[model samples]
Target: MRIKIKKESCTGCRLCEQICTIWHYKEINPKKAAIAIEPHFPEPGIFEPKLCVQCGICAKECPVDAIHLEGEAYVLHADECTNCGICVEACPIDVLYTHADVPTPLKCDLCLKCTEVCNTGALTVVRRSD
Candidate 1:
């Protein structure tokens, strides 16, 4: 499955981030959430929810090579990662966020939890055709 976000529909509610963090980590911290909504400041009243393009830069740049493509998604082996920040620098969209307290980075797994709760219909999951 894959998620496609309609940027125009996002209301800056940030409910996607909240639900993601809660579902994945059982917490309310937005910083830990895989998805991020960065406001377009100076333009006022505009928000952009960053979507993971599923690009492999993070996996490709891992110094320990800890991030691996497993079963259609990049899964990070936190234990194996040396936290060299190479992947963080490689992400073109800046979706990868450094966990303030943890050595590992956080990103979307295309789990679709955000899709289920998005009342705006901004998020969607579709099967990838082989």
Candidate 2:
């Protein structure tokens, strides 16, 4: 499934980010979460919940074929990755992030946990036909 973000509806409550990090890493750190709620100041109520849109560009550009589509989200196979950082450069929207502790980049895996806790309806899971 793909996640649809309604940026305007975001309240910056950060429930999505919290749940994401907890589910993936068993922590409460938002920085390591796949989803990020960024604030755009001087723009009134603009909080963009940045995430993977599952465009498949990262998977297509990976030289080692480390990345693949899990429904509409991209899933990285850590063993196949070469740490070339090619996929990071290849992502058109730049949602992929690297952490100091993790070998591979962090991104949404479509666990649906974030969408389940999104109180503002900013995040929604969208299932595709293919």
Candidate 3:
């Protein structure tokens, strides 16, 4: 299943990001989180959650074939990754991210851990994984 993001409903609490980061990395670092929270300030003051929708563009664009679809989410094999950043650039949704600590491009795996802690219904797991 994929974690559907309702950007307009996001409260900018960053709970999803924190949970995802702690679940995967055992730390409370937003920079290491696969999910991201972006804010639109000034007039409309809303937050946008950047999550993996399993578009598969990152997998198709991987030159080393290191990326693949695993239960509808893009899974990057870090051992096979060359850190070329091609797939990161290929992401249309701009959810794929690169960090100094990570050699492979990181994207959400639809683990649903973030959804468990979300109270605002901003993040939810949908049946569609394809």
Candidate 4:
């Protein structure tokens, strides 16, 4: 499953980011969240929500073979990661981010936790045939 974001409905609340961090890390840190909200000022009420589309670009570009496809999701092997930032650069949508407190790169595993907390219906998970 991949997340579909309705950019117009987003409020830049960061609730999705907060829920993701709390669900995965058991902490309240937005920096650790897999999803990110990029605010667009001067445009007035425009927020871009970046999320993983499960494209597998990061997996294919991992020189160390740290990223692998598991079923429909891409899983990261942190032990094999070299902090090369290759995956981060390989992401077309700029969804992948380097971990703040670790050497491994952080990408969404399509856990759907962020969708649960999205009150504005801005985020939803959809299954892809490919």
Estimate the Cα RMSD of every predicted model relative to the unseen true structure.
1.9, 1.9, 1.7, 1.7
Could you give me the TM-score of model 4 versus the true structure? 0.91
Which one is best on TM-score?
A: 3
Higher lDDT: candidate 2 or 4? 4
Off by over 4 Å in 4: none
Q: Please write out the lDDT profile of model 3 over residues 1-130, one tens digit for every residue.
A: 6677788889988888788779987987878888888898976888988887888888999999998787667788888999999988999988898779877777777788989998988988878633
TM-score list, all predictions:
0.89, 0.89, 0.92, 0.91
Runs off by more than 4 Å, candidate 2: none
Local accuracy of candidate 4 as per-residue lDDT tens digits, 1-130 = 6788899989999999899878877988889888889999976759989888889889999998988898788988888888899889989999987666856777788888888889998998777742
**What residue runs in model 1 are displaced by over 4 Å at the alpha carbon?**
41-44
Worst 10 residues of 4 by lDDT: 97-106
Candidate 2 local lDDT, 48-94, one digit each (tens): 98888888888899998888876556788888888888888988888
Task: Go through the candidates in order and give each one's C-alpha lDDT.
Answer: 0.81, 0.83, 0.84, 0.85
Q: Where is model 3 more than 4 Å wrong at Cα? A: none
lDDT of residue 15 for candidate 2: 90
